[model samples]
Target: MILTSVLPELILLSADFGLIGSPRWRPLAYQYGAFWAGLLHGWQPNFAVQPVTMFLTHAFLHTGPMHLIGNMLALGVLGQMILERHNTGQFILIYIAAALGGGTTYGLLSHSAVPMVGASGAIFGLAGAQLVWRWQDQPKGDLSHLRRLAELCGGMLGLVVINLLMWWLQDGQLAWQTHLGGTLMGVAAAGLLPAQRPILLKIRS
Candidate 1:
């Protein structure tokens, strides 16, 4: 499933580098193959096909090597854990919901004309889902559970601080907005799922 999620990005990237021998290059090929596939797919923000489609399409696109590698790394690591605990379908659901939520938030809120792209939103969504899952299965009145939640909260806070610092240092190029939206959507989506006994819970019991 992780491979499935990554295949589109790889195919589009092949097109971007002119590896496919097509004339499309730079902005044309880049716009079509990377970051904002929505433009090439005939779905311009605020003008063409339903914006919702962009949510899914944009996620499959990426800006550059660093962008692609960073996102894929997160997807590989976090996605694997989530998929192990939940079914593939549920993992996919969280991903889709997070992408849509991130894109929606960016489309509605960002003032920049530069096309938004990347899997950070969905990756953050995975993190959000993991947090929720941990919290949900935490034992009642267990000090260990409380400690775990606290640690999780601390990690989240650290991430937020890092994002804020990056946003400032980079002169607001970072899409913290999408990250925020994706996280919220992930948590909400995970909350809707029926609770399951985590492996840790089993061991403790």
Candidate 2:
């Protein structure tokens, strides 16, 4: 995860990768508060004093196994399609762009005091690109797929509603704003990815 952030700097600035950090929770924190106290200090900090610091850093952190698993599942399903079509260079560029795109979009829209995190937005970017490519290349054969995709968006909207409701219950520690930003950006990006014609996909359906 940190590798994505550091690659740009490593290539340009020749900077050491030691200082960049991720602040995630662990299973043993309660059992060893003494050791983890410093972690808490780093994880949550004053945004007014460190807006640039958290804007990028926060995306790398996830709550626990459950949170990480849920996010990775979404990323895997969506990211696979993008990866298969694009080369390594294109993948890296698109992924980081989407990461920053989603993260920054969330940060800009947020009304909450707590900071934002996660890579769902980036995954959504891949989704957006896939939807665009499909539209540009495949002119026919599955209007059902289109409707199902629309339903999928609706289902995700429902999930967003649920996320917000639960977030309200938790007194607003959650950041659904990021999810919203990512989803929109993902949709918008569909129009942006250049159309590529593969031989097999071009054949009559």
Candidate 3:
């Protein structure tokens, strides 16, 4: 069941690996459709599919091996944790919403012609949802809530610092806009769910 949640990333990894070393496959990927700024701007070539579909499809594409590896790792770890607490349906909702949120942000802000690819945005969404869920689960009217909230924020802070460091190290190759968009959507979506009202809730004792 857990593996199904990350099936998209796994399928993407397989596709990326197959494309490697094949000069023909590179052109094929673009021909089929990959997300780019022009999709929303109405400048995308005739070969590309509808822009709306690309928003979700783009999440299944990656630039290279390392790119796929990092995202898959984050997805596996965070995804498993989230699944343990929330139902699969909620997890899927957050993932799709995060991807679209990221794509929309990138489409609106980026000027680059190159297609933005990877699952970083969705992964960050998982991280954000995880943080917010922990915060929301805290007991009410107690100092313990404050402490748990702080702990959640501290953990998120570490992720932010890591992202910033990676930005510097990669010479700004990361799409931080996507990360921001996904996070906002994830946190908001998670918070909107009714507290302790579902049978799927798996609160750890």
Candidate 4:
């Protein structure tokens, strides 16, 4: 069950390995798979559904081993946590929504002609969904709940700081727009999608 739940992550890792082994494959994959904002603006040549497909495909590609490992690790942890509370289908939906949301935001906001790759946006989405679930599980209509809310806020602030540091380290190459979009979509998906079991009910029981 655990392996099956992480099938997507495994597939992504495998794809990354394949790309790494065949140096030539990386360029081809980036050309066809990575999300290019120019494709949306019609500045680049249309390639038969590439604009739409790139939204999800880009999440499967990574810039390097470290990038792939970082995203997969986060996905593995967050995916398992979500699976514990939701079904496989819900988890998949959230992931896809996040990828699409991230791509859309990047396309709309970023002016870079360079193709964007990596699953960080989807990882952030999972984090967002987890945050929502955690918040919802807290005791409401009470003073104690405020503490939990503060903690959540602190976590968000930490994420922002991390993003800023990464952006600076990467020389402003970090696609933060994607992260913002994915997070918003993940939070929305958590509320909109039905859980496999009510978290609070499970906790109380």
Residue range 108-156, candidate 2, lDDT tens digits: 6654434345565666566656655655554356446766467556656
RMSD of each: 4.4, 9.3, 4.5, 4.4
Best by TM-score: 4
Maximum-lDDT candidate: 4
Q: After superposition, how far is residue 187 of candidate 2 from its true place, in Å?
A: 3.6
* Model 3 lDDT per residue over 95-167, tens place: 9889889888888788777777777788888888888877665555443766877878897797789789989
TM-score per candidate, in order?
0.78, 0.57, 0.79, 0.82
Candidate 1 per-residue C-alpha lDDT over 68-165 given as tens digits, one digit per residue, 9 for 90 to 100: 78788878899877876888788888998998888777766666557777778888888888887866666656657668779668767866897798
**Candidate 4 lDDT (Cα, whole model)?**
0.79
What C-alpha lDDT, on a 0 to 100 scale, does residue 47 get in candidate 2?
Answer: 37
Q: lDDT (0-100) at residue 126 of candidate 2?
A: 65
lDDT scores in order: 0.71, 0.52, 0.73, 0.79
Select the stronger candidate by lDDT from 1 and 4. 4
Candidate 3 lDDT at 106 equals 82
lDDT of 1: 0.71
Error of 2 at 160 (Å): 6.2
Candidate structures ordered by TM-score, highest first: 4, 3, 1, 2
